[model samples]
Target chain A: MSKYYSKEVMDRFMSPKYFGEMKDADAVGLVGNPRCGDEMEVYIKVREGKVESASFRTLGCAAAIATSDVVCEMITGKSLEEAVSITEKEMVDKLKDLPHVKVHCASLALEGVKEAVKKYEGK
Target chain B: MKKIYLDHAATTPVKESVIEEMQPFFSERFGNPSSVHRFGQEAVMAIDKARKKVAHFLGAKEREVGFTSSATEANNLSVLGAAGGGHVVTSSIEHSAVLNPCKMSSGSVTQVPVSSEGVLRVEDVLKEIRSDTTLVSVMYVNNEIGTVQPIAEIGKAIGEINKKRKKKILFHTDAVQAANYLSCDVSELSVDLLTLSGHKIYGPKGVGALYIREGVTVSPVMYGASHERGLHPGTENVPAIVGMGKAVEEIDFRKGEEVKRLRDKVIDEITSSISGVTLNGSREKRIPNNVNLAFEGVEGESLLISLDSEGIAVSTGSACASHSLSPSHVLLAIGLSDRMAHGSLRISLGNETTEEEVDHLISKLPPIIKRLREISGR
Candidate 1:
């Protein structure tokens, strides 16, 4: 296990529960850039005003992948408003904490989710 | 779960023979070489013998070899000591050990660009030399891509230029990586100074050597007693010095060919099996032990971590893994796009690398790349 990541982060990275593209995703939000070494696309399937399913695909380090996984898990089965309101701190807490250098990963995950939600509401 | 080390460019394990040779120096023969007594003389004689051995390995004279704490120091002495604030000419991809000193020097520096394959052209270096330029330092092999620089050709070109110039330009090469696979004969290469590291060559860390050709003047980087001819003034690391000498003597080019076979096998298999994998650096001019590859639509740190979990060690040029959060400068210098640079991995083999280890790596790599590409939604 890498000292750069928490055990929870490593676990999520190795076996991401919500990894892959959602074929039926109602809204998709992409954030970060490959050039910056972390790019994430968040997929959300909504039913009646609640997130029916959520998934993500990330190109990044272990922390970024884990953060994306945790963000998807956090928003699933939640109202669209609640999902968009998820804070970076809450996601970081879910991953047990990130290396100082990797804290930006949490921000990227949050941005991805917000972008997806905005796309859903606009439509 | 056997752990495999493929980061030879970072450092190598000290050979047992080198350890055995260093054993006596740490305790029984621990006297200071600078002291005047039987004990000191014993240490002195051992140092002399080690110096001669290292000098012989480099095809240089005993008096030309001066031991430093590490190759970084040796490089500092070469760039800062020789140039002494005069203009310096160097390449874009030199190790920071050489690059940083050149920047810190009072003299203006001209960093010549390299070919996209990471090979420095002799004329590019020759064209950068100014009337005030006193030193030109280039590495014999790039640590990242393992591209072999044309040190001999560049050295000869500089030598010809020196014949016409009033003040001759001194040439230097950091042979730390090339020492294992290439000829380091100073005269044959026509370099006025050279740098080498012990730890990179299966010897203990904390000992490196700088070769200064006769009549070439270099000032001391530090001040202390008249140790190392006052060029590097400090108490010598006797044991590491002895180990470095033993390691240098044990270098065999025949073993390098076997390593080349294994390296080729890994490259051929990975590139053939994986569709988006691209080899970095010049295929023909690269060293035997290096294999740098870039995988499309995948982050290198993720691949490195996945391999690490499988008991295999590797390195990446990804910004996520770097301290400065930027992709490898060497990769960028070679004209790789930022995305490509961030997706690159470096696997360096060593003397102990075997066919079994290579097979294990080959079997594990394709699946990992597939998984990462899938995760990235490729």
Candidate 2:
């Protein structure tokens, strides 16, 4: 029903994929917005120059939460460099659409993941 | 799963009786209340009846209540009109409707902070009052945390505080959230002006009233026609006013026993059923309908979306300001980290909500938290 995400994304949000974290993450990034009260912590497990696993703990709106779940699915098998390049537009496209109000939440999740990957690279 | 509505604190659906009562005003009694003909007389009679109904509801004299576009407008008028370039004192947690307007006006407000549990400190309010304080505007109930301010105590304080000062400081309350759950009588609350809205009480939107104590003068916010005694000026939305009155005319608040039973069931379920959770509002003093809880590991926004997928409709607080990137000011004021603020979910119950729906929510929420937490691996 929302314009920002697809039924597929909403379905993933409801019955999310790639949930749970690696027992030992190579690196973790915690980012928060003190103003709006939204926060996300992402964990990355790198192996053989690829992102073998991805997990997130998010304190945000539904869009941010569901988007994180979707991001995990999208990044799990990609190279660290590739995963870091993920965009909110890509997530929004995957969702088919999101409302204007929810777009920021999607962007936050993408940024949170990228920041986590950057943490892994010491950037 | 079938959907259930619980967020009545945000806004409620228009009742059928109110809808029926409003029909004639739109079609038949469409004349402006200011006209001087039979058509105008009919419209005038209707508005008078609606005004008297609103006044009677508040147990004030018939001429005291002035109709406005919404409770927000009434609050603006009361806060602005009463303080003519003089000082104002109000709560830090007032609905942005009151707080923002108060901030923009010529007068300044003290904005006394509430306790973490959201109780207004009576002493802090007293401390804020001074010789230059021309008006004291406090809300009867808080919208975000569902904390009820001691308006009666504040009223007593204002009464005593004003007796010593020569300015005759007026006392006003944004009583929009309190009308359904609390008493409507202004005398019992001991205030000079009170603001109320219809949509919050199952009436149509865009119609509200300000109960100004007789002989308590205030400058008009909108200037034009003599409608609403020049205090408010506009071609009245006759239908919405009728609907508002009808909504008040019928009082069907869910009972204390029922409210407690359902409130406790949901609180027990959310607190016990789900992990990584913390209730944001003060449980002891909160409105029975509101349940704002924070999940530590998972973001409230993400949880909100996941739950939405299960056909649930809830919110973090007021639906109006939910979209902003910043966390809730009220949450921040209570000492929550950005993490705690983002993880909050506000579940407000309604008349139609049943035990089964609550059980369904209880069943659905834990898995989402568990799944989200796992994804984070923290």
Candidate 3:
């Protein structure tokens, strides 16, 4: 049985959305290990104090990759301050419902936002 | 479509001869071996004959072999049955069956560390030994990393400590994976206690044996009617025990040589064809039927999925804990920096594996690793 990630999640992880980097960006941050179960990296482009462009790459379980994809969609046009507070529960909620084993992938999304906002503020 | 079975270490199909031998026990001649009736006598003689075969296989006295539900139970009886004392000595790479009981036991356990090669240094084990040390349990061969330990040498050292200190310390080994291909003679290995599971040797599950030298006293972990001389209780699975004995009888020490030849072919191909690869454990000391490796810049779960699609089966070291995605404790103890550990996979071969399957795996695997690494941009 497929325990952790669903077909939707697998598709997103296999062919991730907004997965590349940007030379012109307000913030860039990456968390997790490639050799580890999951890795999430975020790049944000801010325009007039709003997130104009957001991209991510997730080297993780199917849920982790899908959450990163959805998180990018969720954060676009939102203020950097608001984006940083995104929670894993909200991420899983966006995906309808993730498998019991992969709920932690949602938390990785939260960490990515938190770190990216930190990077954004430093600049 | 050709489907290759490379997971022999997990379990093997029951052989035809073993099945034939066990047929009568299930139907026409069914009887409790402990009963005094004619049917019971048939069961009793059969059980005794099988016991003798298993004992002869392990080069131990027939009376020393006590059959149990499984190797996991046998391991518990060995580790949890420790003489209350200083600490237990063991390797970090031991199977959870051994590690879990040791971890939960009241006796403090010092998990002797393993190098990147996954070999436990005798000196390191010796360093862990102390005046209050009650037992030293290490596997004859590692299940994940495939490393073969020097059980005899380790046992002898433990024996020397017993003589010097005039203590009753015991030496135990979980020889399940090792028993299929390795020489597991307890006398030659100088082990006071040993365990082997039936499933690992192509017999049915829930049946195994523990060899306790005539004088060694192990406190029974399970509370039941005094059975197996009070070591294990409840009705025995005569059919499975018979199968276990048959499996033991069928193991050809020469299979070790054949397995090594196949192992070299598969391992050489996979590591050579793939990039950013590392074979985990002691290369020289590993079992001939096992291979564990990590692909850098790849998630093991993802790789496993890709292989699953190709009809190839394997296991990643990390398993999801109850409601939590956690890496394997075995990998964590070996200190693989969390990430390196997740990308590891265990591919164990069986008696029926073929060179064609090895070639197919080698051809199919490199592309997947390359594609996954590239996609992840690592």
Candidate 4:
């Protein structure tokens, strides 16, 4: 195991949850920088004002993938407004702790979710 | 749990015989080689023997080899010590050991680009050579993709140029990755200097050797009591030096051929059986032990972790750069998109690597790629 990666990060990376695409998703959001080598897409299935389900597709390092999965799990079952408010810190906190270099992954995840919400609202 | 290590390019486990040979130096023969007493003389004898053994292995004179802490140190000395204030030329895909030192040269440095397959063009390097270009450093085998450059040809070109001018141009090859599988004959390569590492060749870490051809002068990078002919000044690391010598002597070229067979099988199987998989470097020009592959829609680090969970060790890129999330500069230089470069994995084979281990990794990797892809929703 790498000294830089936390156990939770490893666990999340090893068996990521909320992975895959939602075919009937109300909206899909993709966010990544080509130089960073990390691209994340968030798909949301919204029913009423609450998120019925959430899933993600990500191409990146361990932290980026884990944070993408974590963001999907965190925002599920929350109201649209509440889901949009999901902080990047929440993703890192859920992962126990992210290395300083991997902090950008959390922001990418947050951006992905917000982009998905925006797509759902027809923005 | 069965453990399968495929990260040989990163570092290798020390061989048992090497450990046995090095045992005495750490304990019973613990004395500084510079000391005048009998105990110190024993240490000195061991160092001399090691130097001679390494020199013999490289077809070099015993006095040509200088011991250093690591391959990085050897590279620093070769680049900075030899041409501290002169223009340097190097390929885009050299290991940091060579690239960093060249970048730090007091004079301007020219980075020649490689082909899409990661092989450096000798013509490109020759074209970049200017009158003031003091040194040309290139890696015999690339650390990231295992592409083998034409070192001997480049060395010949430099030699021809040196003969034409009053001021001779030096050629240095970072052969750290090649020491295990390729020839290091300084004469055959026609290089003025060569760098090698111990850990990469089943010897202990923190010990390496640099071959400076007879009459070639490289300024001292550090100041201390005269040691390593004053090129590198410090107490000799007797144990590591002895282990490195033994490791070099123990290499069996036939075993390297076997490793090539397994490496090709793995590469053929993965590239043929898996979807969206591409080989990174030139198939015929690559080192015998390297298999660098890219899986579409899969994050490299996630794939590495997934493989680790299955007791299979691999790397997304160079082990030295694994801590960074950025894509490898080598991969980028070879014209891979950021996505393809990020999704690449380097699986290096060693002499001891068995067919079963290769088969195990072959059987295991496709599913991991599948899982990551499925999760990725790509």
For candidate 2, give the docking quality class from DockQ. medium
Judging by TM-score, tell me the better candidate of 1 and 2.
Answer: 1
Clashing pairs in 1: none
Scored by lDDT, the top model is: 1
Q: Which segments of candidate 2 are over 4 A away from where they belong?
A: A1-5, A23-59, A69-88, A105-123, B252-256
Using TM-score as the measure, the top candidate is 4
The model with the greater DockQ, 1 or 3, is 1
Model 4 scores a C-alpha lDDT of 0.89
**What are the per-residue Cα lDDT tens digits for candidate 2 across B38-70?**
888888788788888888889998789888999
TM-score quality measure for candidate 4: 0.96
**Deviation from truth (RMSD, Å), model 2:** 2.8
- Clash pairs for candidate 3: B117-B281, B117-B282
TM-score of chain A of each: 0.96, 0.84, 0.84, 0.95
Q: lDDT tens string, model 1, B1-378? A: 899999898889999999999999988999999889988989988889999999998899999999999999999999999997899999998898999899789999999999999999988998888999999999999998999999999999998998999898999999999999899999889999999999989999999999999999999888898999998788888999999999999999888999999999999999998989899999899999999998998888888888988989888842223665677888889999888888999999998998999999999998888888888987
**lDDT of candidate 3 over A40-63, digit per residue (tens):** 888888887778989876666556
lDDT of 2 by residue, A18-121 (tens): 55544698887677564655567777888887888888766555566677777877888899888878888898888777787777777777787788788888
Give fnat (model 2): 0.71
Residue A31, candidate 4: alpha-carbon lDDT: 95
- Once all C-alphas are superposed, what RMSD does model 4 give against the true structure? 1.7
Please identify which of the two predictions, 1 or 4, would achieve the higher TM-score against the true structure.
4
Better of 2 and 4 by DockQ: 4
**Model 2 chain A: lowest-lDDT 10 consecutive positions:** A1-10
Which ranges in model 4 have alpha carbons more than 4 Å from their true place?
A1-7
Question: Which model, 2 or 3, shows the larger TM-score?
Answer: 2
**Native-referenced DockQ of model 4:** 0.65
